[model samples]
Target chain A: DTAVSQTPKYLVTQMGNDKSIKCEQNLGHDTMYWYKQDSKKFLKIMFSYNNKELIINETVPNRFSPKSPDKAHLNLHINSLELGDSAVYFCASKLRDGETQYFGPGTRLLVL
Target chain B: QQQVKQSPQSLIVQKGGISIINCAYENTAFDYFPWYQQFPGKGPALLIAIRPDVSEKKEGRFTISFNKSAKQFSLHIMDSQPGDSATYFCAASTLGGSEKLVFGKGMKLTVNP
Candidate 1:
């Protein structure tokens, strides 16, 4: 079984449009995270959730909001997506006490 | 500022050769260091990891060398094969609490056969 899974493998949207990406993990992890990989392949943390509690909120725009309904799911919703929002969004999860994070197949977002 | 910095953004090596990637971190609190390998269209996967307590950790052809005082670490791939070509990212995280991982700009490794 896929330990971590993400939906909408590819997203092509226009500016001012809103979109959402979904993530799910079956590894029974307690912490889930969202990372953004830019065109330069630089990966940076966006948001983190521990058992549905917001923990780390990086210097991301307010347009990007992460919602975790449960421990197994964390979804990202962007309001009025901009051109700079074009990048790969990855979902990762790991045990609360562990350091290893398993990543899901990234969702390629292209905001035109 | 980038907490963890990686060197040689890209490298090309011939098959059966050795490929080395280096990384440096500014945070002393970072106790967990890991290397993640990612293929095209795929998410990064954990390759190998080490802690400040150890200077070196080897698993098969992949090895990680860490220097706590200098806050430096490296990944060495022995007998690099074409199948091993991928982008490798060096990351560090301090355990406990949120444990947000800091990753360096990945290094793209191309192994030519």
Candidate 2:
């Protein structure tokens, strides 16, 4: 079984379109995170939820919102996406603070 | 500002040669450092990690050398193999804080047979 998984392995959308990516972790971790990897392969943390509570929110645009219905799932919703939104989105889960994080295969988003 | 800086954006090594990737962090508050390995079309996976208190750690052929005073660390892979070809990322985080990780620009390593 996969420790972490994300739906829509690939997403291709036009500009100004809205999209959502769902992530689920079977590792039974308490903390989940969303990271964006640009063309340069630089991974940056966008948001994090600890047991369904928002704990870390980066300086990302308002268009990006993360919702965690429960500790096992965290979803990212992008509103009015732009061309710069093209990147690979990865979901990660950690057992607790300062622990190794397991990552999902990632969802590739291409906004035209 | 990029908190963690990684060197050799790309690397090539022979099958039996040693491969090394270096990284430096400016955040003294960072207490945990981890290296992640990623293959094409795959998400980065935790390879090895080290804490500021530890100077070196080894797991199989992969080793992490940390210099807390210099705020720098490196990953050394011995007996490099083609199967080890992948992009490696260095990251840092502070425990009991936001717990958000700051990742470095990845280094792509190619082990040639």
Candidate 3:
């Protein structure tokens, strides 16, 4: 079984459309993260949640929001997406503050 | 500012040769350094990791060399095989608190048979 999983492996949408990506982890981890990988393959952190509490919020645009319903799940919602938002979004999970992270396959978002 | 900077965006090595990827971080608080391996259409996986206190760590054919004072780390693959070809990323995290990892751009390594 996949430890970490994300839904909608591929998403294609038009500009001004809103989309959401769901992530779930069964590793019994307390922290979850969202990362964005651009065309250049530069991966950057977008948001992080520890025990369902927001911890790190990078300088990402306000259009992106992360919601953690529990310690096992964290979802990302993008509003009014633009062409620049097209990228591969990854979901990762860690046991706590000291454990290594396990990542999901990743969701590819395409905006036209 | 790029907290973690990786060099040689891509590398090609012979099947039996050694492959090395280097990374440098500016933060002194970073205590844990990890190297992640990623294949096409797959997410990055934890390959090996090292702490500032340790000078080097090894697992199988993979080795991680770390220099605390220099704030630099590197991953070396010995007897590299064609199956070892993949994109590798270096990441750093603090001791406590958020522990949000900062990853380098990435290094694509190709081991030619």
What DockQ class does candidate 1 belong to? Answer: high
User: 1 or 3, which is superior by TM-score?
Assistant: 1
For DockQ, candidate 2 versus 3, the one ahead is 2
* Candidate 2 total steric clashes: 0
Q: What is the fnat of candidate 3?
A: 0.86
lDDT of 3 by residue, A1-112 (tens): 9999999999999999999999999999999999999998888889999999998999999999999999999999999999999999999998874569999999999999
Which order, best to worst by TM-score? 1, 2, 3
**What DockQ values do the models have?**
0.92, 0.87, 0.81
Ranking by DockQ: 1, 2, 3
Q: What's the lDDT for candidate 3?
A: 0.93
Deviation (Å) of A49 in candidate 1: 0.2
Candidate 2 lDDT by residue in tens digits, A1-112:
9889999999999999999999999988999999999998999999999999998989889999999999999999999999999999999999874478899999999998
lDDT, residue B14, model 1: 99
Model 2 Cα lDDT, one tens digit per residue, B1-113? 99999998999999999999999999999999999999999999999999888899999999999999899999999999999999999999998888788999999999999
TM-score of each: 0.99, 0.98, 0.98
